[model samples]
Each structure stands twice: as structure tokens, then as C-alpha cells.
Target: MPPYPTGSWMPVALSADLPAGTVMPAQSPAGPVALWRTRSGRAAAFADRCPHRGMRLSHGFVRGETLACIYHGWSYAEAGNCQRIPAHPALTPPDTIRVATQHVEDGGGIIWISVGEPAAGPPRFEGLAPLRSMVAEAGIAALEAAAGTKAAGGLLDYTHDDRAVQLLLAPDGQARTLMHVLVDEDSNPDERIAASRAAEALRRAAEDIARAGIAR
Candidate 1:
């Protein structure tokens, strides 16, 4: 079986973690990506590299609707077009000076980035609230061993201490996983806390399995 689902909209981050007018580092099947939301609360994803001097745009800061490179202050609009060059304030940047962008969807409290030209929108899990996200230093096989079952559609159903939750996972490179925890929408505060703790324990268990060189 495949490690996890691929070639569709991938859950990259929780919407709550990314406030408006902020930029964050993310991943894509193509390469590293820069995910950001504008001051108007529009989300956009771009190839992380700056077209001007090869700087990582994730390190850049958001200014209004544009994300500006931290190195030379080259500003790119939400459409990935270079709008301003600080060094040449009077010159308008050419349209060719643009950063590559990808399709983004923010729904069901998650930020989903399309892997390619997907034909459909992201899948939604009704009545699920995102709890938290963390990286596990383990591959999918190790995680499957820890959870006692394999993932389906990039989701794994896990329960601990009679508390059940869903884990949305995406491969972070070769041997790491980006996991997002989700609890029932109506779950109370105490239950949310418990779910978070259970997810942490699962992460530790998976890591241990990976370190022991155990393959599922």
C-alpha cells in the first residue's frame, strides 16, 4: 500500500495558526512553498524562492497585500507578481519578474494547498475541529505500527483513554510527517486537552518505533 494519499490538495497548516498578513513556510510536491494571508484575509501560496536573488520568501515579511523579500526588500503581490523593488523605488518591476504560485483553499478550518491542477476542491470532515499540529520524526510505516492501522486518504483514526480523534498527515520529506490533530467540533475544553496529550503520546510512540529500526 502507499504510505499516504498524494497528488491532491494537501493539508499544509491549520487556519488558526496563520493569522492575517503573515507568511509561513510550507511544502509542496514541487518544492518548498511560502504560504501567506493578506491583510484582507486572502490566502496565497508561492514557490518559496525569491526570483530576484534566490532568497527564501518564507523569511520575508508581509506588507499589506504583498510579501516582501527580507534580503533586498523586493515586494511581490498576492498574485506572485513583483510589484516593488526597494533599491529602484522609481522603477516599476516588469511582469516577467514573477514568483510561481499554486492553488490554495482555506476551508473546514484548514489551509489546503493543491499538489497540482487538481480537478476538485479539498475534502471536508464535518464536525471536526483542528486541535494542533506537530512534526513526527518517523515515516508512515512507523506511524502505522504505532497506531495499529494504516492511514486512509491521508487520515488516521486514533483513540486514547476512550477519547477518539482524527489525524491528518502529510509526508514531510523522506522520513518525517506533518501531523494535524482534530477533535469533534462539540468537544469540550477538557476533551481537547486530552486529545492533544494523546496525539503527543502517539508521536512519541511513532518516533520510538522509527529509532528502533522497526518496519511495519
Candidate 2:
């Protein structure tokens, strides 16, 4: 249902895609998450459930530094603590009334989320920059078969017309996969465009292979 599980950090989205003071809905192995950022440009994720009345927190709005449930205007801090309750403005929310949080790491131009304690930080590609991301109607096996290479250290190596590309992949439970394209950090506009196109073509090929049930 999500990018990562218990001990590993998986790249969920690019850092640029999520702006400050915004919340996006996502699924996780643990549960649904409201991936959000604060006004000051910090990223955090909360269990997408509002313990108050079973509302989805992802449908909530972001305040100065808190996420407020759209239903009753109950606000929660990044740490998942209840910050304010509009109905009881004078009452401090008890510690038991709080949202659950996941481990989030924003680094290397990507956002990583982990369900439980992560063994380490997100993997870094020293000389690669994220170009774009897309979903492919294929499994990881199909992608690896099309690329003719196995994933190493969370990065899949592929060559497109003499240009090297690194693909960061997140596999959904079904046969779908989220592919994030990474290219040389020093690449020019034309090179970046080419790499992006290459990734698209690869996805098409992978999808075809998947449809034919040729990849194992």
C-alpha cells in the first residue's frame, strides 16, 4: 500500500513536488498517511485518521505549523500531538488524544517514509539528480527484465543511447510500480529531456512485457 515497510526508508515522492503547507494522501504498510509540509518548509506525515471522529486527516487543512482536520478544525502538530481543539479552545488536549506519525526523511531531492523505526537514513546518489517520476503498469520483475539489469542498492542502472540513467523504484502490491528517474547532476537541459524520454520508453516496454507475461 505504500513505499516502505518497517526497517527501510523508501522514496515516496520528490521533494519539489510537495510544497510547504500542503498535505497529500498516501497509503502505507502500517496505514494511510497524510503526507504534509509546514509553512516553514518542513515535511512530516501523520496517520490519515482523525481519532476524534474517524475523519481522514489527509482531507484536512494546514495552518501556520499544524494540520487541522477539515471537519471540526482540530489541529495537530507535526509531532502528531493535538495542538488545538476549536470546540474546546480553553481545554488542553490530553496526551492520549493524538495522531500516529511515521518516520519521514527529506533528502537528496526525494522524500522517504518508513512505517516503523528505520535502520538507517535514505540512500543517496552522489552524482545523480532526480529528473521526473511516473507510474508504470508493470512489476519490478518486468522492469528489471526490460532494463537487462538488477537493482543494486535501491538504484537500477539503465543506459539510454549512451546516457546512463538511475531509476528508483517502488513496487505496489499489484503489478504497478512507481518509477523515479535520476540523471547526471551536471546534465544539461537537453540531456535531462532525453533521460526523461528514455524512462518513458522503458516503462512502455516494461508494461508490454508485463502484459505478455514474459517477465519473471
- TM-scores of the models, in the order given: 0.95, 0.89
TM-score for candidate 1, residues paired by index: 0.95
Worst 10 residues of 2 by lDDT: 1-10
Residue pairs clashing, model 1: none
In candidate 2, which residue pairs clash? none
Model 1, 2-104: lDDT tens per residue? 3324557888899998899999999777679999999999899999999989999999999999999999999999889999999999999999999999889
Count of clashes in candidate 2: 0
Most lDDT-accurate candidate: 1
Output the lDDT of residue 116, model 2.
67
Each prediction's whole-model lDDT (CA): 0.89, 0.85
Once fitted onto the true fold, the runs of candidate 1 whose alpha carbons sit more than 4 angstroms away are 1-7, 214-216
